[model samples]
Target: MQPGQQPQPSGSYYPQQAEQYAVPPMIVPSQMPMMMPGQQYGQPPNVPQHMLRHGYIAATFGTYGETAYCAFLKCGLGQIPLMFSIPGCTGAYTVAQSVLPHLPYGWRAADGAPVILLDCIIDQTRGPVVPQEVWMPNSPRVYDQHVVRAVLRPPTFFVHTDGSVGLPLPQILSGNFAVNNANAPVDVGRSSIHLHIKIHGYTDRKRQFQTQESGQWIQLRRLVGHVGRAVDKYLREAEPDPEQPVPRLRIGAGGIVPADVVVVGVVHVSSGSWMPILQLTRALA
Candidate 1:
């Protein structure tokens, strides 16, 4: 079967994989989004999606260049929107969608810009559904922001199990392609994917405050950092060492076998913790 096509039973081999160089298909191959970066002739099988043993990833984001460009886009006047999310009680920690800045309303910041980590308490009684954004409880619960020094750079490319890029590792690149899969050479260096970020502070904790929620911010303010105070000045948080390397979030890292699933792992965030997650992009089950 061709790449992007419906997944088949395991131990399956396609002509291209078996042949060092495969002949063009009788018909053009379907351009499925599952196709990896260098994949021009064919795409990887969705079968591996199921075989993933590690936790899974749910979101897709652009490369570092995209991240930088997004940070500079101007709103109506001079404000740049800040983006971030909470990822609910349980879900893909969509690094790209969440972990953003530019909220307009809410607590002011300290000397530097605000880098708030609000672990908002959820009323599970409302069920297991929680929006990935900062879910503020309406009752009367205050949120605490734990600002950290660095954070994991979200992986834009397919990150393998060994923290390598390209060629899903566990896949036995059968036939001529075996070496390419085995060597797992880094066609693109890994440094671009591993990035760090600076956190800031915010002030004012009125129950109701305007948030920088609009992706299309028609009217923006001065895009400044290190210019505010901590949220709820009373809640004093221990200052973390900013000298440490920022942590990174690898959203989708898959491998071979049913146990080998796409996982969500954080590098350099306290004790490294990895969990099994589901891949929403490629159909596994």
Candidate 2:
């Protein structure tokens, strides 16, 4: 099947004679509002609509360079958008639409001016549901300001999952998952079926608040270190230092500093009745 095309049942996940999975047609970008940076377009606040709150989690980062491989995510922006009918709710959710940031390597807030990128919209419905219109930020809720820090350095692009360059002692990657189905099927009485959903992606460089004198994009360095080092200091303090004679030295070789960069974590959503405890599976998966 094509990358975007939904896979037809070869009797794998579903029965061959059973009805093919229902997949909504793709929504054309043109029919939707023209999504461009600095362009004003969105639905009015007065319009009655279901609000979905979403958070981006980093899945993985392989390298650091001009063209590093990274992945960002778009989850349900509101509370669970879809649910299963079973007493324990269970089912699958295909991404219908999403709005993501067009972040590229080396793209910094200093070089990007206001540091605000375009709001990408992905409509995953069968047809156009709303008219195309430009958005004006007249209220706080409609266009909320999300101040994120670009804490990590530009990702180096030499790493791969194949263990080609000799696996690093510790593997660190960032990304998140979006699960629409939570409950289980109601008809399962004598049979046992398991469903495991895993979503992984690389973390992208986000814009910071700082700007260059020319009004171009410039990044703040301190923010980057904050996300990278804050945890280490916490761990050091928790460790038993036998040589420590002074009462918690504030200034020392290992000092705890807040990270400035926004370290995005790659998220995984795994669910099943006997799906090996959530914490254990995530640690190993």
lDDT of 1 by residue, 1-285 (tens): 332333222211111111222111111012223333454556542222211111122111111112211121111101112222321122111211112333222212333343322111111222111001111212211111110212222222223334222221123121111111222222111221211111112121221122233432211111000001111111133233344232121112341122222212211111111111112113222
Clashes of each: 48, 59
lDDT of 1: 0.20
Q: Which stretches of candidate 1 lie over 4 Å from their true place?
A: 1-150, 156-169, 172-285
- Candidate 2 regions exceeding 4 Å error are 1-101, 105-143, 147-228, 238-285
TM-score of 1: 0.18
Give each model's whole-structure lDDT.
0.20, 0.19
